[model samples]
Target chain A: MSAPAVAYPDHLRARVDDYLRTLRFPSRAPRTDGLEDAMRYSLLAGGKRIRPVLALATAEAAGVDAPDVLALAASLELIHTYSLIHDDLPAMDDDDLRRGRPTCHVKFGEDVAILAGDALYAEAFQHLLTAQPGEPARLLAAARELAAATGVDGMVGGQFLDVAGVSDTPEDLRRLHALKTGRLIGASVVCVLLLAGVDDEAVVRWRGFAGELGVLFQIVDDILDVTGTDEGLGKPQGSDERHGKRTYVTEYGLQGARSMAAECHRAARDTLSVVAPAGATELEQITDFIFTRTS
Target chain B: MSAPAVAYPDHLRARVDDYLRTLRFPSRAPRTDGLEDAMRYSLLAGGKRIRPVLALATAEAAGVDAPDVLALAASLELIHTYSLIHDDLPAMDDDDLRRGRPTCHVKFGEDVAILAGDALYAEAFQHLLTAQPGEPARLLAAARELAAATGVDGMVGGQFLDVAGVSDTPEDLRRLHALKTGRLIGASVVCVLLLAGVDDEAVVRWRGFAGELGVLFQIVDDILDVTGTDEGLGKPQGSDERHGKRTYVTEYGLQGARSMAAECHRAARDTLSVVAPAGATELEQITDFIFTRTS
Candidate 1:
């Protein structure tokens, strides 16, 4: 899980950041003043932007140009943002802080937060639906994939299992994490492949690789919640254990959880070898970063 | 605003009810155990089934057979049910009761309720996406329309405005209700038009008619919320006022609101006459029902 520090070249990272900035809320209609500002409040609050970065990096790795993949990458990030807003509502996780700023509901009230989420989700699909002329079918496929990943059988379903106290076994834990975190990551890679017009075999292999990476990400996140500092993490630490959450850190002890995460990262890197043989060096670098990231 | 009761015929109403029951939750996959049950809980919780009924009735009135329109009608209802479930979450309206029973989140946990809503929303499109192959484009159009209506610019946006607190201006009040309540109803009629495969100028006219009817229906709902009793309405009275919501009744006095509703109902009836010459009588009957209903 360890590799040399290979920072994303400043120019490429800057372009990714620029794409993210364009993904913020559109200005509100004159009749609906303040709506855009509310939406932007949560969206602009800093975080890794990992999902979009994954989309772009994978698309580039698959030979798609940066300009061709920017919208798709932003769409993935919008979907991720919407999920965070809804998840933080008082009914769900009820958190006030997200990314070291007030959660959507806390800043704009639950109604606006809910609407903001709905808007972001819709905008994500709209972005896909109205993609470049030659990209309609691919966009539609991406939209369908995203809808399935975020809806009943995916993120929402995983949340249900989590809150229902159903993730008692390792299999249940895997199912929860796969749907909760893995599907979006998987879809991000799949979207890149679709955009790049990659072969089905490569698409499937990439999805498998991304899914493993997603689970590893979640496992590492759980570990961070226990071992990381609040300043470093940008959100509360130890809340998972406090909330009686069924994280890997809770199900397995700290050392066991660390070992499980390392194994997952190794499996992810192994999967990536088949999917991106030409980009294997970069994939390994990402794996190493995920394994060791403090936040 | 008043008219004598005109039966829809027991056979027709019973047929629609039966169709709704079957469509409540599509047969679940083995892994979707609790998801199926959570969806069914609210879908089966009886209301007038107004949205689905409106869809089916409009289709039949436009010359499509009721059975032929069943899936489309059911899809519309699923969206409505999903909205209700999400709306009742503790983060939203937080009502414990709906349709004389405990709300989904009250009966199930918040997470299940959220999943149920997401599943129902997903299933609505899933049903449309997998519709019988007669009119794939129409199905796709309807799915897209449903997505737009339920997302930010329609129901969700209206909800945002509602929660943000509107002023006493009549126009502001109307805008709020139009989004919150009118759009889904408009979508219902649009679904019928799409499913019926109607392409005449009549489609445009009926959409206009349905949009006005949706506004009228919402105004009547506001009046009822303030004036109707628990037994008649199946929920608490004045709940909107209790929440400090700005409704038609709040912005205008009772008499003023009633007069506005009457005018809208008449306009709706007039538009229906232009759109559905064959079904004008039935459409007018529905308008009358909306204007005079206790709930």
Candidate 2:
């Protein structure tokens, strides 16, 4: 059975939505071709603004109300959108739908979709150079963190391992999730710390918290894959089963996955308490929302 | 008739070759599944190593004997390798041969080939964050230059336009080449100026020089496609004709294209004189190589 839907707090969600609506693009003569349009089509497709939200909440928790990092946050989403575009390619997962619309390749040709994804990756880095919440050094650190998370030993490595079908042991499974999803989610939090120029020790503690949150996200996602309908997923249901891909639910069973997510959520909250103590209300609430998101 | 094979400077070739041999891998347990091997396979596959040579030459021309930027130079090759890998994808050019050998997708399978390209991109940026020849600020500038040159208004955009067959005018042709190849070549020189902390005005001058060289490279390439044969060219000749792709030779005729390349080469040498009046023997030689090469 699925848990009741969690209400993500309205204030943070509103800010992210507003920012996404009015996102600035480089001022240049628009191409007659549809490359830029294809980029915008997928970028503006709505989804849970989870990564950006985590960035803002982490910044606030670190005792800074900086918003310059929103550009960084937005760039993060661009990178995320690119990953989705490529991962859905006919050569990859071969998905037909994403975020309730035809995938980029379905809407555009496969060639245009590939270029769109490639352009976004480049754009994300281009934007990162200019987006600084505090000092330029902080921005530089954020860029480094994002690059590391996106590269081998992080998202790309994990994806390679997944496509290789090498995860037989529980340890391999954990390593895969930690690299594939955990690094980027953790980067969202790390960007906030860098924006605030927090202490190294604090960055360490927050990473510990964020790592658990990332695992919690995958565990919940696995559970939802088993429990979710096509409507809730915004794509085909039972994709993991159909593809025969391994997941937390598959390894631990449905109830076991649920229990593991609960354990992780509790552990993540504890680390947050250690790092922020008097703050992190938003972070705490966001943790629960991760467990409860239907799509 | 093809020009005699211009002797590539043995000294520069040796340096790049020595650097590529036993290139360092980040310390980690090697994945047994051959993802790393795929990345290395494409990376070390012999090409001319032109981009790295350009970077090092530009740095030296800027009055810095800075070998430290070799890491940055090396990362430039990584990006170039990635572009080659993707451009050969089954969905893209679908080529089976590159540099007289099987392409990445042909040897590694399409899936790993895709991941290898993606990972190389990420790894390039990750490596860039550490590859400062001067100070951090200069490094930041270098990073920005690289990112912009790679993004929508640069290589990827030009590629989109090329694939879309959008260039019909001379203006469109110039824009296509400038974005596709010129910006990155321009970046190699720009990176050197940044590394040596050269003034902004100098950067503009060097870029003008590099931009002309980039055009010369392409003009000669189109000439080779028309005039050279399968053995000399390595890949099958007349690919542009077979694919019905547009080129300078197609638009201007062989003699006309040769005159244009000579003009650009002369213009580039003039700019090089202004920026590095005391030196640039290699730069001048390479400019001739771009114009006179048979393969």
Candidate 3:
């Protein structure tokens, strides 16, 4: 009924993987003593690659070539990977496994893991600034977008709220999700729009789509945490519950959360309709993928 | 003999302090639940504004206005502050104090401390890209310089070596300090040159000076770690010994390390003589400060 969730663009993800794989870290000395290995281990650790795939799809929907946005799109994965490494530290979520392997800190020692995360965070900005193909002004704008979304007001701030146990109310829970997860997801889309120099009106419309997509993504993540397997999720299932962290599912029951996801999907589709309908097939497919993903 | 250390430019440091003081972090919601407080707490905790002051001094030495480079200069301090926060984490150095106050993790809890550090890292790039007045290309190049010095090849990589206990030999220790402390210090000068668009030849000469400055700075740091007081350092003195870490002083002994610092100071002066001599006074003053500072 909902166009039978099109398969995640495995072909596109493969391309992204190849690009990431070919990249080399520059070191003052010829070797970084496996610091790069810690970074690569987590970066190449298999995930859905949903954030980057979203950036690529958004590029298409915005009438920009996917190749043109590949590096910028991939930079988001770097930030996401760094966050995972830090978030898994003993002091935070204390995750022991990630993507079916020992967590970064568990494998590399806590110090290397911390340094690896810091390196990746710096590399994300470097890659976006140096590798992305665009006008410098536009690239700067894109960099600023990425920075704003990752900073205290966005992902890190949201993380603070989550760790502080301050997001008790449903309203607070929504704010937490928006800041922690939603902002970076939105930036993945917005950065492409900025690079493309989209008109302000079009930006506003696409932002609406991005906003809904972020909401839908987080809700699905919460649902999967409840309805997933440890193997399938590539980490422990029930972590949210184990941590007693408030989630959409905790605020709204399971069925209610599903309803919210469905609502977001419809809203995303409706917002896409407001833009020119020329290259939106991939975006719609991604929306379907987000709604129906099991893990 | 060395002009009495020129008072370490407290007036310029005060300007950097005021600039950093007035920076208002943007948030989607009105409040970030003290995440900014955690960031501000460490950022304002006070260190000798050495890196930013180096940047400002470099700008002046290159015949550029300090105000033009102030934001970029201040950005270096942000990176320095973030590195300190992470370094003091329980999983890292496990320190309780920084700048005479409780370490970020000690004050804010580990999770908040980690997020605050991450936030500061993002904000460093954000502040540089948005606030520094320059051509976009030049600004992007400046950003890249900061990134290179902060990432795997530079500070973080150096930290990795230190934590891994790999720098056993004098040569490896030199490499470690160069990467860990020297690169960021060098970048404080290099970034200003990039933004100023100095000639390549001038860049090479300035880089030589910066390199010597970095070496001299680290040796002095090592000396202070041994001879300094806890009250003087605002953190525990003799931490390198307590941690069983290798340092210039550990390798060379206190007197030998002091001689090396003096040698680097001489080299820094010789390198500056290769460049235009009209604007070399502040740099010479800074070189003397590095050579003589006890804390």
Candidate 4:
């Protein structure tokens, strides 16, 4: 299942940004009007492109040209972006702002926002179909991974449980955030593996890395919500407390949660050294990006 | 591409009903409590199971046993049922009842109903993973077909266009419904073709058959909505007129719409005759069932 090291060469920042700007989503209906506009509003609105960069880096680390998986890589961001849109729905989180801009529902209206999210979800899978016929097996594997990550067991289920306010304790909070925040990030890594033709044993090791990274990502987010200000967040700070939701910070206290985040981030870097290629510094950088981002 | 006269043996009524009763959805989330129940409420609360039976009958007509594509066939129903649940949302059609029972949002809260629809949509694709691993190409082919059909160029695009009320005349209506209603129905036929390992030429012919069948199904729906009673529809009649949405029935009078439905039925039956095997009578019967059934 292992492969000889071919160090990842590129940063992937430029390549991922270029792909998102250029890729044309396949739409046959003629009256696209504002549908495309609504989708692009959030999709292209600039959120650091962390998810796709993770996928692209993973592909590059596995000794494949990241551009070959560019469409597949960008799809992770689309799914992530769509989840954010749906989560901001008036009926859901009721968030009126995100990414330093108006939320999708606020910008495009709730109906269009919902439809945009649904469109993005379906298009994420549809875009993968453009993978060349020679890569059918790997393509199928990636698509399946994406679905399982975003579907009921992952993002959707996590949102459902979160909105129902079903958690009672720290363990419940850990389990909830693991599914809610963890799965798609895990999927982004797995998409890279399958697309790069990595083996299941290697995939298992990378999943361990992604699991730690995902929790680290969420914990940092909770830390940001508590410590950052509206000027930095583009929304009010202390939102978790406002909603009376128990995040990692709330459960662990500021100092304890910071330690937990650091521990998880360290575990991820350690695992990366094992699963990644020799001199695969890009992945480690991305791990730090998820761990240290303030907004 | 022409198949001989093999009739679609067995009514498929009992088999499809039995399969729907017994098939287990692939859901991993533990706190399924209300989400699963809402999905089942609309799903198991019976309709004719028309779409799935089409896939099965198509499989059977191609000379394989129907159960071979059971997962694929059942997936079509899941998708169809999910679309119905979404369509009946208060922000959408706002129907209170369906099939003589409460609509999902009416029975469940709007939030849960939305979640249920989202769950069903994801589960539809997840269920396809159960298809034969031995036939990776066919399985991938089926999944891709479903995704494309319900995706931007197909169902999702159609729904967006519909809600925006983009149609100006009859041709616009046909184009709208072709995407909205046609693609999934078309995917049902394509599923049977790929699963049967049929060639491309046969697939084209069956797609034509499905195109006609999809329109026939919709025209019949509009007519039933205009003329049927609450006892038959399980919801208030005159929904299309109440909404003032354009339809075949609205675009053409009742007599004209009925003739259009019959014409579509004949065209579908005619195309099926060329595409079906020597004794494929069951498909013709199903076509008639779609046409003549009042409910």
Query: Is 2 or 3 the stronger prediction by lDDT?
Result: 3
State TM-scores per candidate: 0.88, 0.96, 0.97, 0.93
TM-score, predicted candidate 2 vs. hidden true structure: 0.96
The digit string of per-residue lDDT tens for model 2 on A1-295 reads 3668776755776777777677544413245247888888898888878888888888777777737577777878888888889888888788898877999999998888888888888888887785554565776788889988887777878777777888888888888888888999999999888867888988998899999999999998888878888888888888787778999988999999888988998898888888887967888889888977877
Runs in model 1 deviating more than 4 A are A1-17, A23-31, A131-137, A194-202, A280-285, B8-20, B23-35, B61-69, B131-140, B192-204, B278-285
The DockQ of predicted model 3 stands at: 0.78
lDDT per residue, candidate 3, B164-240, as tens digits? 88876788888888899989999999999999998778888888888998999999888999999999888899998
- Which of the two candidates, 1 or 3, achieves a greater lDDT against the reference? 3
Runs with alpha carbons beyond 4 Å of true place in candidate 4: A1-11, A132-134, B1-11, B23-29, B132-134
Q: Candidate 3 overall Cα lDDT vs. reference?
A: 0.87
Q: Give Cα-based local distance difference scores for all models.
A: 0.73, 0.81, 0.87, 0.79
Pitting candidate 2 against candidate 4, the one with the higher lDDT is: 2
Candidate that would win on TM-score? 3
Q: Write candidate 2's Cα lDDT for B1-295 as tens digits.
A: 3557666665775687777665643313235247777888888887777778888777677767747778777778888888888888877778888888888889988878887888888888888885554576778888889988887777788777777778888778778878878878888778878878899888888888989988988888888998888777777899888878889999999999988988988898898899888978777777777778887
Clashes of 2: 0
Cα-lDDT of candidate 1: 0.73
Q: Candidate 2: where is the Cα deviation over 4 Å?
A: A24-33, B1-4, B24-33
Least lDDT summed over 10 consecutive residues: which range in candidate 3 chain A? A1-10
Q: What residue pairs clash in candidate 1, if any at all? A: none
Candidate 3 lDDT over residue span A179-276, tens digit each: 88889989998999999999878888888888898899999999999998998788999999999898888889899999999999999899887774
